[model samples]
Target: MKNKSVGIREVAQHAGVSTASISRALNSPESVSPALRLKVDAAIAALGYIPDAAARALSSRRTRTIGAIIPTVDNAMFARGIEALQRYLSLQGYLLLLATSGYDPEVEFRQAQNMVSRGVDGLILRGDTHTEGLRRLLATQRMPFVNVGVYHPDKPYASIGADNEDAAWRATRYLIGLGHTRIAMVAAMSAHNDRASARVAGVRRALKEQGLPLPDDWYYEVHYRLDDARQAARALMARPERPTAVVCGNDVLAYGVLLEVERHGLQVPGDISVMGFDDLEWSRHLRPSLTTMHLPTDEVWTRAGEHLVKQLSGQPCVMHHEVDATLVVRESTAPPRADA
Candidate 1:
């Protein structure tokens, strides 16, 4: 196909200037005089010489695109965070390319590599689960990225997250204050999840402070599924020495617990109290108005966006960005009955 079209040379001729001057006027306007820069710009528009974006990026070394890799879009928590990030990026003359890794650490690393190769100006990640090998690769490539959900205490990377330990401790203490002596936990696998594990630690800390030790079988390690939560809740409740209250890893798990308790003809805060983390939107709307630790989703997202944009603009990111989670007391939690 013989396509006859205008090029930079034609535009330069139309502007009555050398190609080098036109290139400077288009690529680096600050280096060119105003009178000539305007002339080259008019010529460019008149000739319909659409500049290749990739070529422009290569010459100017900027794509104006940022990448955000999250665990999964299925959860409302991550969805809200990603939305805030995208909105903030758009206002700053940057675009966001989102990817989901389905909570797989290896997949997160691969997605990060792919985003880097695609020439993103910066990247945002959900947690610190990215393998050390991937970290090395990013460092070697000089790619700029920030951790959004969790923090690494010893490192200098930018991060924005709530105090998982404190949130968990508060939730547990609330349960204890309500006279829940035997408390059980239904948690997602925390081996590779620093956030989940920290939450669990907070629960233990509260228990230890209260001179209580969790039963061996009280800790249910399973995937974060409602069905699994239901089955696990049933098993826990069926035990001879069941907990008077249950603290779920998240709202989804708490919902499952409520469902299982209802099926067993048990009333929440009557027979048992149930608490959950991450005050999901539906938490307040639920029948019992769930009691949960309200993770500052909006704050977390806004701060992460601010940090990433600042870094991309060659500004120093805030050293310690920690937000507190608010505890919402609702109808779902109460003191355990003496009878169990």
Candidate 2:
């Protein structure tokens, strides 16, 4: 005959504890004494018991899994963060279910609801634009949720991210200090992306502080695609008087801008300076390295995972964890040409 599966009752009996204690140790380890928890763990090991996830969910009313909904993962920035989140969640003995929202609020709501319907224990939403319906659903279900990438502490979910405005401000100020007053910006659409919105504000704030004028044509808005970025850059450069310095929203946009600049036989930094955000992998390898902000994506996602795990385990968790990005100066930025 095949060996029987080691059930919770069997482990409890072997450990000289009630089934309740075993279940408590499994569901909420913080509620159990360390000594008793150790005993339970040893018993589980000796018996080679594997908790049936389905049965455990039935008993504890928890899926022991988290769902994360982000914008597109076409960029490495999002990919790196999601990878870190999955690794951390796995280490904590929980699973991560991910979905992409395509930066659409309605799609976000649908994916969020779908994840919950699949019985996720907690949820992670990106940006600051959680739908009222989604918020109500999470509130009504009493599920723990956190918003990553944008920090809005006064709101319901705990947030983990950098002050995007500050990061952008630093990037812009660096360019201004290089004596490049006519700086152009190549940015993603700011419709619903809080990061994009804050970055735009930061650029504007820095320029206004220095009494620099930002002409209407100096700002180009495009999607995350390089094609769009390339088109935007080409168009911006075609203006009556082109900007000497261009600040791109992210490395992808910066890469496209650089390509456009090179296509026209223009030099980088030597003729026009360029700066990018996100400090992506390829930023350093370019012929003229990129000057950009290094976002702590891995750290941010890891901390968010830990926060959700703690909340799910009945352990105390920090309500909000703020992170900051560092400005990296590289070959892509410099003082404008003397003739300009």
Candidate 3:
């Protein structure tokens, strides 16, 4: 005769623990003591028990699913964070549901509503510039959610990310230290992004500190696409008084800027110096290795996932988790040439 499916009760009995303990061990491992969890795991292995997801959902009202809505999944910067989030969530027996807004707040709100309707237990969002409708929906539902990519303690929502303003300030200051007064920035559009807005603020502040004026055309914002970056760089260079140094919003933008500058017969660090943000893998391998800011993408998203899980387990979570982004000096940046 075929053996009946092993159940939680059977596993608990074999493990000499209560059904409640078994449940905690399975869903909220952090809540259970190490010794107790080990015993439950051993019993589960010995009994060959497979948890009944449906029953757990019914009793706990948990979907064991997390949803994330980022600006754009097509970009590798956001893709790396999403990958890290998925790995951490899966380790906790939770599935990740992903959606992208193409940088549109309305689309992000619709996606958030759809995920909520689908009964996600938690959410991980890129930034907090979501539509008011989505904000109201989340507040009304009282669902656990964490914002990733920018950190602000004064905000109502919980967040786990790098301090965008400080990081950008440091990056800009590095360029100033290189003795480049004619500086320009190619940045991501700040229309609905707190991170981009904060970074722009940082750049402006850094320039002000050095008594350098940031003229209207000196700072350009565009989408997170290589082609847009190329155009922005070309336009900046076409100006009557071109900048000797350029700061890009991200590595991809930096890639585009570098290519455009080279296409114009300008030798990097000889006529112009460029700086990039986000020390991505390719940044290190570029012909003239990039001098950039190293944002901890994996660490931030992994921590965001753990924070969401803790909140879902009815545990108190830290509201603001900030990671550091440090400057990486490489070959692409140097003091402007004497003649230039």
Q: Judged by TM-score relative to the true structure, which candidate is superior, 1 or 2?
A: 2
* Pairs that collide, model 3: none
The 10-residue segment with the lowest total lDDT in model 2: 1-10
Model 3 has an lDDT value of 0.88
lDDT of 2 at 46: 92
The true-versus-predicted C-alpha distance at residue 240 of model 3, in Å, is 3.2
Residues forming the 10-long window of minimal summed lDDT in candidate 1: 1-10
Ranking of models by TM-score: 3, 2, 1
Per residue, candidate 3 scores C-alpha lDDT tens digits across 1-340 of 1125788888889999899999988777777888997898799878778777777778778879999998877778788998998999987879899998877889998999999998999888888788889889899999889999988789988988888888999999998998889999999888988888888889889999989988889889988889999999999889999899998888899999999999999888788888999899999999888999999999999999999888887778899988999999998999988766
TM-score of 1: 0.84
Off by over 4 Å in 3: 1-22, 32-50
Clash totals in order: 0, 0, 0
In candidate 2, what are the lDDT values of residues 1-340, reduced to their tens digit? 1125778889999999999999888876667788988899899889988878888899888878899999998879889999999998875568899999998888999998899899999988887886888888888989888888876677656999888898899999999998998999999889879899899999999999999988889898899988998998899879889899998988999999999999878999887899999988899999899999999999989988988988887779988887888999999999998889
Q: In model 3, which range of ten residues has the least summed lDDT?
A: 1-10
lDDT of 1 by residue, 159-212 (tens): 778778888999999999988899999987787777888889999999999999
Question: Who is ahead in lDDT, 1 or 3?
Answer: 3
